[model samples]
Target: MSDASPVHFIAHFTVTDGDGYHNYEKRFFPVLKPYGAKFITFDDNVTVLEGEREAGRTVIIQFPSEKVLMEWWNSPEYRELAAIRHQATTTFSVSVIHAIPQR
Candidate 1:
C-alpha cells in the first residue's frame, strides 16, 4: 500500500460566480492546510465519458489518509470554502471516497 495512490472522489456545483477560478484554487490548498488535501484536480476535463456522468464538475483531492480526508471534509476550513462555492454555484454535492490501493 505504500506506493498506492490516495484519492477522494468529489463533485462540485457552481452557480458560476465571475472571475478566474484560479484565485480560489490557489488559496484552497493553503486553507486546507490543517486537514491536508495534497492535490486537487478538475478531473472531468481531462477524461472523456461515453454517457452522462455527474452533472456537475468532478474534482479529486488526494489526502494524506482516509481518516484525514474525513476530518478535512468536516473541518470548518473546508466549510468556509464550501460557502463560497455555494454562492458561486446553484448547488453542490461532496462525496468522500477512498481508492483501493493499487497492488
Candidate 2:
C-alpha cells in the first residue's frame, strides 16, 4: 500500500436553522464524491474528556490529500451550497488536519 497519509476536513458548528441546514446536508455527499472525499464521522453526541468543550455538531471527512480537499472546498458547486450552511449555522469552524503516519 502507498504510504501517503489522508487529510481530514473537520467541521464544528451549531445549527441556527434546522431546515436550512438540512438543505445543505442534502447536497453535501454528492458534491464530495467528485473529489474523492469520504465521511469518517458525523456526530452530535460529543463528549469532552479534557479541555473546554464546544457545543455543536462535529463532522470529519477524509480526502486523499490536501490538494483534493482544497479542490472540493473551492469548487463552484460547493461554494453555492456552502451559502446554505452559512445561513443555517452559527459559530461554524472548519479545519484541515493531516494524519500522521504510523511507523
Candidate 3:
C-alpha cells in the first residue's frame, strides 16, 4: 500500500427521522472499527463555495486503502447497519475519493 494513497468515504445524508438516524449513528462506530476505518468528521455546517448548494449532513471517513474501504463497505456487518441508515435517512450521495499524494 505504500505506493498508493488512502481512500476517503464521503457521504451526504438527509435525515428524515431523527430517532432512527440516531440509532444508526450509535451503532456505526463499533461496526466500523473492526474494518480499520477511521472517522474523520461529520459536518452539519456545510458551505457551498461554488455552483450549487446541497442540503444534508456531510460525513467523511478514511480507510488505509481502497481495498480496505471496499471490504468494509461490502462486509455483512456494515450491510446490516447500512439498512438502518437506509430506513432513517435519504442519502444524497456516497463517494470514495482517493487522497492526493503530498509533496
Candidate 4:
C-alpha cells in the first residue's frame, strides 16, 4: 500500500438464513459498490466449532481511501438499501481501517 493511494481494510461477516442470502446479494452488493473499491473476496460460509453449526457469509472490499468510503456510506442512495439489509439480515460485521501510510 502506498501513501499516495490510501488503502482500506474492510471486512463484512455474518451468519445468515440460507434463503435470505439471495436478497442480500441482489440488494446489498450494489450498495457496497459505489465506493470505488476492489471487491477482493466474498465468502458465504462461516464455521463454528463450539457453538451450533450455522451458515454465514463474509465480504471483503478494498477502497482507495477512508474519505471515499465515507462518501459512499453517507450518500442517499445507500441509505435506503442499508435499511433493507438491516431488515433482511440476522447479523453482520462491516469494518473499515486505514492502511498505514508509506514513507
**Candidate that would win on lDDT:** 3
In candidate 2, what residue range of length 10 has the lowest lDDT sum? 1-10
Q: Per-residue alpha-carbon lDDT of model 1 for 54-96, expressed as tens digits?
A: 4456666777766677677678887877676666665457776
Q: How far off is model 1, as Cα RMSD?
A: 4.2
Against the true structure, candidate 3 has what lDDT?
0.87
Q: Give the local distance difference test score of model 4.
A: 0.64
In candidate 2, stretches whose alpha carbon ends up further than 4 angstroms from where it belongs are: 1-4, 101-103
For model 4, where is the 10-residue window of minimal lDDT?
9-18
Give all candidates' CA lDDT scores.
0.63, 0.86, 0.87, 0.64
Give the alpha carbon lDDT tens digit for every residue of 17-60 in model 3: 89999999999889899867889998887877878646789999
In model 4, the Cα lDDT at residue 25 comes to 62
What is candidate 1's local distance difference test score? 0.63
Q: For model 3, what is the error of residue 75's alpha carbon versus the real structure, in angstroms, after optimal superposition?
A: 0.8
lDDT of 2 by residue, 1-103 (tens): 2335678899999998999999999998999898878899988878888887577899999999888888888999999999888899975678988876567
TM-score between model 2 and native: 0.88
Q: Report the poorest 10 consecutive residues by lDDT, candidate 3.
A: 1-10
Clash totals in order: 4, 0, 0, 0
lDDT of 4 by residue, 1-103 (tens): 6433655555454534445556656776576776777878766665555865335556667777777777777888777766656665655456776666567
lDDT of 4 at 70: 75
